[model samples]
Target: MIKFLVLCLIFLFLPFQAATRKQILIGEINHELKNLSALKIVVFKPTISEETEYASMVIQAFRNYFVKKLAFDLKDRENISIEVILITDKEGKGQIIEQKEDQGQGTVFFGKSKQEIKSSFFNKEGIQIYPTRSSSLKENLELPSLLEAQSDSVLFLLDFDNTIVLRDDQYRGQGEHLKPLEYKIKELLGISYPKILPEETSINIGDKAPNILLEGRKLSDYQGMILVLTFYPAAYSGIFDTSLITKRISEHHLSMMSCAMHITSFDGLSSKIGGLGVGYFAVSESTPEILANWKEVLETYHIQYINNPDYSLSKSFGSYNSNGYNKRVCVIIDKKGYDILPISIMINDYKLGKKKEIQEIVEKLMINI
Candidate 1:
């Protein structure tokens, strides 16, 4: 729950000195290993071009560095050379086997395919892998590349074909693959980082929502109100987040007919939307007190009578068909059954400027309605 922004400390560079900052940013890659343990990495060289050039780059960076430089950093220890393979469709599908256990490490691939750059830092050497051909992905493989990890084993997977990264713990990223190789490693390893775990990525509109939102709730009961869901992990302190953006929308009197108000789809139709409780190492937002607080935010925004939505992303809405979530996304579902992803923004995709784009979508919706 600690804000992951703390990782910025590592990137802050020298303050007030533009030249110093640039020097750090553009300077040569630091080859000195910073006491970080050498990792066992799998370099996924996909025979097919299913992954984007960037996704391929991420995989290669890991391979290039560990194979050449990482071992040198820990010369006293056995140099942990990376193993590589050009994963096939059948290989990606094996996450399909799905027997999940706990212990984990993450995956990294560093190198170049026709799609990726050869290398950047900590090393440029490549590890060659002999890959076995994969059989076709099966129709019943419900989950996308969902794989079980060996204790501390991190599976770095290239998608089934050439899509983006699938939503698997082992599938580190998607379309807007993390830049360079180093940062990708940071994010995947954040969970086990020495200082703090990284924040959960924002959930956006249009992407299939987590089932936790609709579990045990009945969507049939309330088929009348449109739902606006705001998602942040239980770890986020977004108490003021909904109120700020919603002030503009509230001015439009969105609650003219509903009996009550809600946000985060929180008050939409279920109490479970209150966010994970203390049991998950987070404070409970489901208590009546918290409900009152959420209601206050809704009221402040002039929203009313909208019970939390009871529809499961998969069951009620007929399956949460998420090609995959890009960045933090937010969606609007009209009660009459029009699903408008006017706010399909991926905050992580910086080039897309998704946050501003989402605001524009919201404004446009207000104008149209």
Candidate 2:
């Protein structure tokens, strides 16, 4: 009996990778996420202070990235509404414009607050704080009263409403035109800023993570590992910059565990790429010559590439990289194999190159994670 008690205690204390998710569902004892496929999000139409094509692009880009790529079930409903109210000093109060979309069957979205698992994920609205041209308002540069958010516990974000409004409104005056507007994401979301939006898990600390692999190495092999997985599209013009990526990785002797996606355009401008395995890229249509340039890049940079399992897109494993957004950003995944997957995304500009920053972030993440 004493021996039996000791055995039971040992079993109880062991960190079972599959145990945390066990109680979530009967059949999904091994599944890390609990019915996350049914998340219903309402993307409120965005309001911009000064109307421009960029604002429209940002809004639509966010919406499509959420609904289509991230696989959220976004639909219009009467239960909640997030009306983007842009109080600009330009010329008008704000305009309400509606766009339509189809709803997909996505899973439940939830988050924990204080302690209890509460549904923090809700329909989103935005309030952009910008110093408009101010045909009537004050001329001296300052945060106008028109900039304060009118909130009823509504989730808000910094220039989440306007990415460039910061540049045009305040930064240009300050002479910081080319920086990403770093808003108080915490103040806006009332929480830590997510590299990826709608981080929908209750416990991430020690929960067993779902497997994310590249080439042939299974993530399970690194059960206790935390890696910085960067996704790059071979077709991006930036990928050709050998000094930026190849030289940096070689100098740092970083792990070469990466994957490349082949894109084939149905139309001359639109294309389809991978969503499967451990990757996502934002790309547009390109010719066979550009696709073949991966070899040239490898040879020139002396960068080694990993080969992944040949899988079909119909296998429900990959996604679409629309509008060349993949070329705009690099995905840095924190694959804590036996826990939640935390990501640190870095936007890449072919001109400015992210080598130094990427290397620093990777080293920091490697140490901390």
Candidate 3:
């Protein structure tokens, strides 16, 4: 896998850059989006209270939140707009702004001023509140009135209430709210950006398979029998059956047997490698430790493993938790202790083809070996 820092291609602002400058950074927003979505759609307090510090973190969180959600909807969204606002009140309880989604275009929102926010907050009489377009406030304020008073030129409203929280607030506000613009931008760009894939950290056809300690055992234990070493994420018992596993077996010769190794622990038990209704070997190390050992083996072959660990091995692996598991993978270890070939597979969700898949994998392994 290619590993290079994303060079921020900033077009130097000449004497006069474009009338408006647009800078974009792409990333995966899955983590941020999940975090935000899990929380109740309401106002959250900032850790920092100083005007600038509070504003900055709030803006970033908002950007991270919205951009992540937006990108999730449109995976191709690489850029988003982030605007900042500074509002003040006797009490600094932030107002919750509502969000609305565009038809695959992106998202937009409006920010409120100090007076506007205070009026809205009191009108609703709730500290944790989300403002809405039609919310009736003591000042007879409306969405347009709030938008007009915002300091920022443009803002992206996530419309969380409309999109997710489908309920009205008790009084002046709504339950779902819009995050700030900058936060939304980062999240959107992050979510839209594709994650880096994992690399194959195992030996291949022509390379020597490195020896290692496997649960107080050595990697050389299975040197003679055609070693079918499979690595799967622990929680994927459903999809890791015949088809996804066996499809890769078709490439090998007959006489080779396969074994499945789940890398994740079950119910906090000590890590054990199990296959064929038996415990092959169990390593107690955390996932990171196991991956480090795998990396050494791959690098010895002058090959780079895809670091994705999110999808197929593809001779590349990484710490990415794609599908909540390491990349679904399998490897053929030759009698002489060489990794003859590696195959990456993806298990479709809830597609109950496990029985057929397992059967096909075994047949393919028997035939190809």
TM per candidate: 0.24, 0.25, 0.23
What are the runs in model 1 whose C-alpha is more than 4 Å off?
1-40, 43-55, 70-79, 90-125, 133-193, 197-351, 354-369
Question: What are the lDDT scores of the predictions, listed in order?
Answer: 0.28, 0.28, 0.27
Better of 1 and 3 by lDDT: 1
Ranking by TM-score: 2, 1, 3
lDDT of 2 by residue, 1-369 (tens): 999999998887776533321221211211222233322221112223213212332332223232222211123222222222233333324443433222222311212222121111122233223233343213222223333322111111213222212112321101011111212222233332213222122222233434554434564554444433322332222122233344545565443212221111111011121112223222222223322333332232222233221211101122212211122234345554335455454333222234456546555555654
All candidates: CA RMSD (Å): 23.2, 21.0, 20.0
Q: What is the per-residue lDDT of model 1 for residues 193-248, given as tens digits with 9 covering 90 to 100?
A: 11222234444445643333332443332243334433321111122233333563
Best by TM-score: 2
> How accurate locally is residue 233 in candidate 2, as Cα lDDT from 0 to 100?
32
> Residue-wise lDDT of candidate 3 within 1-369, one digit each (tens)?
123222333434442353232211111111233223222232222211222122322332233233233212343433333222122222334443333221121211124333342222122111122222222321221112222121221122333221211221211110012211222333433542334334434333445444543344454665434333334332111111233324534543222222121222110111221233222221111123223323221111221122222233323322223223333333433343244323222222212223245334434443444
Evaluate residue 224 in candidate 3 and report its C-alpha lDDT on the 0 to 100 scale: 36
Candidate 3 weakest ten by summed lDDT: 170-179
Task: Name the candidate, 1 or 2, with the larger TM-score value.
Answer: 2
Candidate 1: Cα lDDT at 70: 30
